[model samples]
Target: MSALLSLRSVSVNFGRGEKALRVVDGVSFDIDVGGTLGLVGESGSGKSVTSLAVLRLIPERLGWSTRGRIEFEGQNLLDLPADKMPEIRGRDIAMIFQEPMSSLNPVMTIGSQISEALFLHGWPNRAKRHARVVEMLRLVGIPDPEGRLGAYPHQFSGGMRQRVMIAMALACSPKLLIADEATTALDVTIQAQVLELMKKIRSDTGTAILMISHDLGVIADICDRVVVMYSGRVVEVADIRSLLQRPAHPYTRGLLESVPRKGQERERLYQVPGSVPMAGSVRQGCPFRARCSVAVDKCAVKMPPMFRFAEDQRAACWVSAEQSNAPVIEDLK
Candidate 1:
């Protein structure tokens, strides 16, 4: 089976010459058909930038160049003509952004907003579009969608707006959905509902998802494969079960430990120590060396490679890979 999406050595750089900032560097991963791949990292880790790059949504006008392949269903989207993106973007691959209100048109009626995609995609006949919109609203658990059609975004609750966004994104039945922090703004109960909704959509439609967020719990709950990134590079990738049970990289473990567990009693939650470095701050060695508990002399001098630690797990840490019997890889310049 072909992968729904693939990112091969993808890097995103902004600005020109000495002012260039590599926001995403040498990152690679894939999502099999109907698979959920999570990109977990703190703020400025480039998770969101990676997602935008996948969608060709990055502001290249500000002087940016994305290096490497971004393949979707065997087509390198990076090479696809810009004018041809309409057939691919919402029709083949869609995205639900972080904030619902910001993504939605506040002045437009919910009904009109949802119907816009159907119309743009050549779904003529207002009656059929109305029916589809209502069906979509109902599918996403909206109450009396037909009656609520004319309501503006502010009228609905936060969760409701998110559901509306999901409905709009899935309305086209895109084969891939890039959900960038899809549930970060909702309350716990609503977040659970939205997460469950996304899972159901994947199961029902066979739509692959690239879930990006800093929430380990959310990643463990929804993703089949997880990618750990730090300061713009992919440091680890593993199956969700192995990642949650036996994380290979110190960064991955630090993230899991930092989250507040359900029944654990502690004076304070564990922290990874230090914040995510700003763009272009760390230019050598392992990006996490400054904070890694197991860092060695080599970690500060040579960049670590993604060494396979298990059949399906890989990490980019000198000490962790060495401990796992993964051969130390020299500078991969």
Candidate 2:
């Protein structure tokens, strides 16, 4: 099957001069139609920026792709004319941000907001557009679509606002949806509901999803495949089951260990030692070298190429190929 979205060596850098930062570095992955790919990492791992770059939503003056290609549906989206990019964005690709409160307009009525896409895409008449808006709301499982139309974003709770965002994103039935921490702000119960709704949408509409989140549990529930990012690079990529069962990279392993699980009782949660290094402070060799308990002299001197574990699984770590020799430490100091 052809990939709905593919990023070949995509990189996004911001600013220039002494303070310049490379937020996303040489990352590459693909999402097939009707497939869900979860991007998992700590904050500042470049997941959000990478998604923004793919959507051509990176800030104009502050950021640009220093290199690589963003191909969507066999076309290089990066090569498209600027004016025409917006047409592709709303119709063929859509995004649900982390914060719906800030992402939605406070001044606009929810109906007007959802209808905007249909209007822009030329849904024919105002009556048709109104009907489309109500249909979208219903499709997203919102109650009382007729009454909710006049409501402002602030009138709805956080979960309701997020539902509006999802309804808007799917108004035109986009082929690929980029959900950047879509459920992060909601309560656990609501988060589960939203996630289930997304899964239902994907299955029913056959829309591909690039779901970005730091929550492994969420990913395990929804994603068919997973990509683990560390300091702007992909540390590991595999089938969801494979990754959860046997993560190869030390960073990936660290992430799994950090999460609480059923039947597992521990006083304190495990955390990867040291924080993600500041973008500009990154030096030569492996970006995770400083935090990796398994790092060796070679790990500090040379960056590892992505080594294949299976046809679909890969990890950028020298030790993964020789797990017996991989370091086994109780904790990092």
Candidate 3:
């Protein structure tokens, strides 16, 4: 399958000159058409920032800037005129932000909020837009869709609000859906329901999904391919099965081990030693070296290029690159 969205050497920085901080550095990946890709990492790993950059939503007034190519359907989004972005943002690519409460307008009725997207994207007939809004609410499992149309955001529970957000995002049938930490605020049962809803939506609409989360379990539940990130850089990329069974980068391994297993309820869960370093703090070398157990001298001197371990697996680690039986691909630097 061809790529639906491709990010090449995409870097996002905050501030200017000597004090600039690189929050997302040299990240490259692809989401194939109708496929699900997960961007997994801990907080401060730049997962959210990367997704925001895709939509050109970063606040430029605050000294934010993004570099590198973001291509959708063979068009470089970075090169597109600023005024042209709004047209593509809602109709072609829609995002489900992390917090539904903050993302939604508390004062607006649910129906009006959803219909706004349809209206902005050319659903001119008021009757048709209302019908579509009702259909979307029903599609997302909301009951009494028509009756609830006048309900304010404060009237709905957290899960229902999130479902409304999804309804609004999918109202126009976007080709790509960027869900950033969509399930984080929900309880376990609600989280599972949301994931299942997303899966059903993808299957029914054939929309490619970019699932971003700090939970590997969530990623494992939905993603076909996983991109593991540490600090501001991507450390590993692989098929879900390969990454879970044999993680190449130490950071990836640590993330997997930290997840509590089904039968290990009595045992204390393993934790990755130390916290993620602040972005841009490590000017040279691997950002994970301080936390990695297997770091060598080379790890401290410079960052390792991505090494190929299989047809679909790659990792950026000196040990993995040097020790792998498969030929290393050092051109990713």
Location of the lowest summed lDDT over 10 successive residues in candidate 3: 324-333
User: How does model 1 fare in lDDT?
Assistant: 0.89
lDDT of each: 0.89, 0.87, 0.93
Q: Which stretches of candidate 2 lie over 4 Å from their true place?
A: 17-19, 324-333
TM-score of 3: 0.98
In model 1, the runs with Cα more than 4 Å from the true position are 327-333
State residue 9's C-alpha deviation in candidate 3, in Å: 0.1
Best by lDDT: 3
lDDT per residue as tens, model 2, 99-210 = 9789999999999999998887768689989999999999888899999999999999999999999999999999999999999999999999999999999999999999
Instruction: Give candidate 3's whole-model lDDT.
Output: 0.93
Candidate 3 per-residue lDDT, tens place, 231-324, comes to: 9999999999999999999999999999988877655778999999998789889999999999999889998888888889998899877777
lDDT string for model 1 (142-204, tens) is 999999999999999999999999999988888899999999988999999999999999888
TM-score of 1: 0.96
Of candidates 3 and 2, the better by lDDT: 3
> How badly does each model clash, as a count of residue pairs?
0, 0, 0
Kindly give the stretch of ten consecutive residues in candidate 1 with the minimal lDDT sum. 324-333
